[model samples]
Target: MMSFLPQLSLPLPHHCSSSKPFQNPTVIALRSPTTVSNATTDSGIQFRRKLLYLRGLNVNALEALRKNPEFRSTPLRTLKSVETCLASMGIERAALGRIFDMYPQLLTCDPYLDLYPVFGFLLNDVEIPFPDVRTAIIRCPRLLICGVDDQLMPTLWFLRKLGFVGRQAITCQTTVLLVSSVENTLLRKLEYLRSLGLSCSEVANMVLRSPGLLTFSIENNYRPKVEYFLREMKGDIVEIKRFPQYFSFSLERKIKPRHKLLLDHGFSMSLSDMLKVSDGEFNLRLTKLRLRCLEEFPSAEVLLLNNLFLISVLTPKDWKRESSISCFYLYQLPLLDVFVYWLKILGCVNPLIVLDFYTFPILQFSSIIFIFLKCS
Candidate 1:
């Protein structure tokens, strides 16, 4: 079983022969401790510190600096500290991003403008469940524009997206209240509000609350939609259509004291005719009609003097101070002196005239007599 014999040498493979192959050589030399120290120092201060610290203690030198108070306040140092603390404590990036996202850039740009308090209040009070800041940046409150020429605004569209249909409804309701209160005429504002899914009761409440909001104007005469809102809200709220509205003559843009009064008084034409008529009728349907435009027509003294004669013959209720009339608002005819005199003669002590010229009209000498007469 143990036969020892000499074997012949076979030819080696081509790849295995060292002399025929192209080979690359790499040289590596282990340095002394002084050389290692010098090499580590040349790398960087932080690198050198990390290298030295890694050899002895278990943790990095940056981790040691994190607990140092001297490097605490500066933003860069604080950031480094936070980074190390987060790494050591194993905090995730996603959670920090979620909390930081609530801070608005505008607030951050000017925090000393009391922005922090305002932002904090809004953050606490407005409990909208938005997934992130992007959602809040896009949405806000909206105001529904009504009147004959109303146009939608960008905010209105945004509000609609945010489920604010009430503004649109309010506009319609306002029109309905306007038409219903004023001589029972129908308006389109009511219909539009109804279309926006608000009830008649809602519109009535709005009218009672914001009466001065009646002065609304929109673009060149669109077919306004307010008829339904008025029809439905009728009788539910107090009638405010012809309720004694007043405007101080002092505040009027054009009309002035010492100016010849253009008493564009009672309308002889029917309501239909007046509605159908053009602006040219402003001259014909007015009270006094012929008062000058001040620049052209010299003195109104003649007309005022002649009117005094007429004033003598008429009863107090019919006292026609025609040419000298100061408050000549045609639309609000029920508030003129003629109606006030009539109301007074009919034992109306408490006159509800719009033009109450108390101090100027009633002098100190005549005041006592007037008071005596009123008391009697």
Candidate 2:
């Protein structure tokens, strides 16, 4: 055709010289299994790195990949959808890293199929408010991984039967209780409290009042505190029933130190008063007790009643009103020295008297001086 078309020149196969079309070197390289595998590995690594960076996870990406193999095969769009689902539920971006690090399986969960059911149970069944759903999840990240039908629903039913209903219903603060196993954990704790002589109603009230009570380990928390309270502190079980929060205090750090200090000073306080005050306030109370000279005369009320002259001076009205006057005010009277001096001069050598200024309605000091002079 002039032979119109030019003769085509193509590289022949080294082995077969068949009439097969030549493939581009670039295309051949791209189609190689080794090259494809390397590309896929690189893409997966890049995706994992991106996930780590986006979630603020301070972890080794390779370790996470190894721990969660499913995460490697999951497509990026699917992961983004999971992130979006959590974000829509009020979970902060920063918390996602911790949550994912703790529960890497969450990374591959189908947002609708696996995740929404949990949120639904928390909202509808548990009655956790929409805003507090984030709090419940953050407080117990395991809640996200818990199965709705198997774990959560059963736990809710158990708690309600144990009296976590009505005004004493579970709240965001107590959502951690949802993760406890009814048989191994929750019921065992309840039974232990019952073994302490608490009725079912009483145990329920205690747990309702202090939700952390159910979380305490009997071997670690309950037994030690109860032993100290009974054997060392000589406290009654009734006190524990009244103040179940008593177990919440640390034995070594708080309860022991404070109780030891009180015993050292021969002072006694109710459980609530002893453990509830700040360290500074407790020390201040002890100081004031010392200043009042209460340690020297522990029976000041009885001693005051036995003093005939002091009793005679107190009119019926004054006697009735004296009950309102605190012993602190009685000891810190402004003219206490003058009263003591007058009493000493009147043949009362040891005058440990407690007087209130308002005990004499007309003239405070005048009435005391008149009474002492008239007696002399």
Per-prediction TM-score to the true structure, in the order listed = 0.17, 0.68
Positional deviation of residue 280's Cα in model 2 after best superposition, in angstroms: 1.5
Location of the lowest summed lDDT over 10 successive residues in candidate 2: 367-376
TM-score leader: 2
What does candidate 2's lDDT look like per residue over 1-376, in tens digits?
Answer: 5788999877676874567554544444347898899999999787866666644645455666778888767787787788899999999777877888888788788999989999999899988899999998888889888888888899999888888898888888888888889889988888988998889999888888888998899999999999999999999998999999998999999999989878876779999999897776776576555434432333323334222223233322233311222232333446767765765675643433433222323223222221221211
Query: Which segments of candidate 2 are over 4 A away from where they belong?
Result: 1-34, 37-41, 44-48, 51-63, 294-376
Please provide, for model 1 over 76-192, each residue's C-alpha lDDT reduced to its tens digit, 9 standing for 90 to 100: 333334334323323344332322233212211223232233223223423222232223322210111112112222323332332334444323222222222221222344343
lDDT of 2 at 73: 71
TM-score of 2: 0.68
Residue ranges of candidate 1 with Cα displaced over 4 Å? 1-167, 170-239, 242-251, 254-376
Clashing pairs in 2: 1-4
